[model samples]
Target: MKYAILTADEPFISLAELKSLLNNENNIYYFSGIAVFSGDYKNIARRSSNIKAIGEVLAISNDPKDINEVIRGKCFTIKPNVILRSDKDRFNALYSTATKGVIFSKKCETLDLIFTDGIIIAGLREEERDSKSLLLHAKKPYSQSGTMDAYTSRLMVNLANPKKTVFDPFVGVGSILIESAWIGYTCLGADIDINMLEKTKYNLKYFGYTCDLLQSNIATNCIKKTDAIVTDPPYGKSVNAKTIKIEELYEKLFSISSEILSKNGRLVFATDAKYDWRDKIKEYNLSIIGIHFIYLHKSLSRAIYVVQKR
Candidate 1:
């Protein structure tokens, strides 16, 4: 069995990202902050932005006594969930007695002990996300006011489950394309504004990444069939929404995405949560995989949708 520790702030989105990327796996159980499943999940920790850690499940039990046996001679440190705070002292004592290495010392692995839904899950750490890399957003050469942070952009790209090519019709500053290209995908991007396309090219080149850029409106352009479509369309601003209404832009997006995506390909996009898009999805013959909402502030929230071809 495998386990993943998801980001706390956007747990549902994290779970959706995991499911979309690991569609072939069987999820045995999951809650807000953790998931236990069985699958051939290798390098998933690095591939995902929301998953904090991914590793093999060492043991699971209701009794805390079993931990002593599990940690015998193991050079590891125990990390418990917030729910297990009351038992922290007890867990510490057990670890002190059973562990072969000093706590917090080098070469000591981390053991994730989470209590969720009346079960205790123990997972040994194998891989973890590089939290420092999230700071790359501010370091990027070109960014507009609403440019997505690196973590969120990477999460959206992973949700699309791109196998080869990733197309972003509304490539604003190339946030999505940067992540897709970084993941070794053949990236294709289009924008109605030639200036935005130039900024995307400059920003991508800053990272030594390359992508096909086109200065064509998504509503009229016909892109070659791509394995996935991951994009963040214009919201409602001069820097973003350009001439079209948000509603009409989304309608065009759905129409073009349906025509350009290959069979079984996925479409992952973000939009304002105020508009209802379920009907448009059905009309476009797309199957809904998941929808997650993130509130940015008191007045704004973004809805991310992941859908696959029917």
Candidate 2:
């Protein structure tokens, strides 16, 4: 069935994250801010961090009357939500039909009435979640000083779409792994630092989730590759790869990844280094599908890369 994915505040990143979670399925079409795609219910029903809402396409037009009239024929015992593009006022010739339903009840359906770029679409909503509460719960009292936030970590795991298991080569304080485990993915993490691994253990226990974390070098990963990998490796800050050539470190990373990742397995990671490694990725039989840059400050920025074995 065709579905509509409502994007978050940052439309670009949200759209990219959603597309990746959909396994890079670019059958997506956009008229208004809503993104439309086709997928089975089992694949689409799973909760995703980037998807604000899901709906079935009902009609596409500039006039609200056209949308409202379409909904009128298929009456709902429940009043589905009437959400508009950018929360626009729901009116114009279809006021009577659009205003015929109750809200804030046990009803689970939604009507996405959006207007953007001179187009409007009406869709039947399926699911919605409380992102704020989830984030608040993730922001536990215990946190690493420079580790990635749980929200971004969750986004990365979501983008990777780990099926049976997920791994992290450099799981500092278990930020990504914690989020991955919470999402019900069998998680495994490795780090060269013993202290960090201990902290990771406590962090996972704090969240009432357990993960397999070991103290191992990235160049020699003991854990077998699984469905997906999400990690944040140190690039230039403390514990940087200064003892060895940065190029060599990256080479080993991709090489081991190529060996460990199963077919169709995804590896999503972030680094601060600004270098073109397309040739290196190709050498390892991997292809980079998506990359996003987060500008944190004037001196530093993070580049997120999503790649899969070719």
Candidate 3:
């Protein structure tokens, strides 16, 4: 079956990556992409066509029902195979495709419509309920630098063992921590900002996640060692001046990470700067496992690193 996995903003790259991730399936062919809120739809359409060569074009709106008309028309000439909806629009889209039973929904906030033999698959929200709500609320008022969406967190939990404890040293608003807890992992979160710590506490409680929150900086605090460390650290742009210098911040992060991370433990983190993090990994003697590039906005491409303690 030709499956389309919708990705976050500027999804072309993510779609390609998802295709590679799903490379085991010989029948899957990533045909096209549907973009939302992007002003350059013409350019995206042109790019999509250039990439897929013979794919259809569809403009996605806030309403899922609107897509039905386009899909029914087979405007792309490719039959409706399966629709992978983003987490943000999953609920409404799911309602729209309630009758379809073969749908496969990836835990992401982007939509990917797949075309198998012209049959749409059914989708169910897989991430824990409590975690999704908490992360949504946090992104509203105060923005974190390199935060993961609820679907990404769900994917992370699915990729890793949920039974293992996950720690977030720079747990801004506790999005990752709460999500980890919701997925049945013992979570530990710490932050330097008192306000963020307080918010993290409230959000965790709101999500009914019985996790630990520490008010110490990742640079100076003594946090418990864990099986995994999943964090979105402060980038040069979003952090305070004292913590903005890339070299200094990374130095501190390495120090703290080295101290608390257990032997062979996993550390998954993201950053948006142009720094050479590979050097830091080598300097710290950490084992590089995998790296993913996620385009957050038009200009920002976050580098997500999955490293293991040596």
Using TM-score as the measure, which candidate wins?
A: 1
Q: How well does candidate 2 match the true structure, expressed as C-alpha RMSD?
A: 3.6
Q: Model 1, 1-310: lDDT tens per residue?
A: 8888888887877787788778754655785478888876777778678988888888777665575467665666667674345656655554444333335545677888776655567778888876665666447888878788788889998888877999999888999888888778999999888999999999999888999999888778567699999988877454244556777888888888788899989889888788679988889989888788888877778888888887
* Per-prediction CA RMSD (Å): 2.7, 3.6, 12.0
Candidate 3 residue-wise lDDT at 80: 35
Candidate 2, residues 104-160, lDDT tens digits: the string is 234445566555555556676676644763576466656665678766787788778
Alpha-carbon runs more than 4 Å astray in model 1: 83-105, 238-242
Candidate 3, run of 10 with poorest lDDT: 41-50
Best by lDDT: 1
Q: What lDDT does each candidate get?
A: 0.79, 0.71, 0.53
Better of 1 and 2 by TM-score: 1
In candidate 2, list every pair of residues with a backbone clash: 110-125
Report the poorest 10 consecutive residues by lDDT, candidate 1: 93-102
**In candidate 2, residue 91 scores what lDDT?**
38
- Report the C-alpha displacement of residue 297, candidate 3, in angstroms: 2.0
True lDDT of residue 298, candidate 1: 78
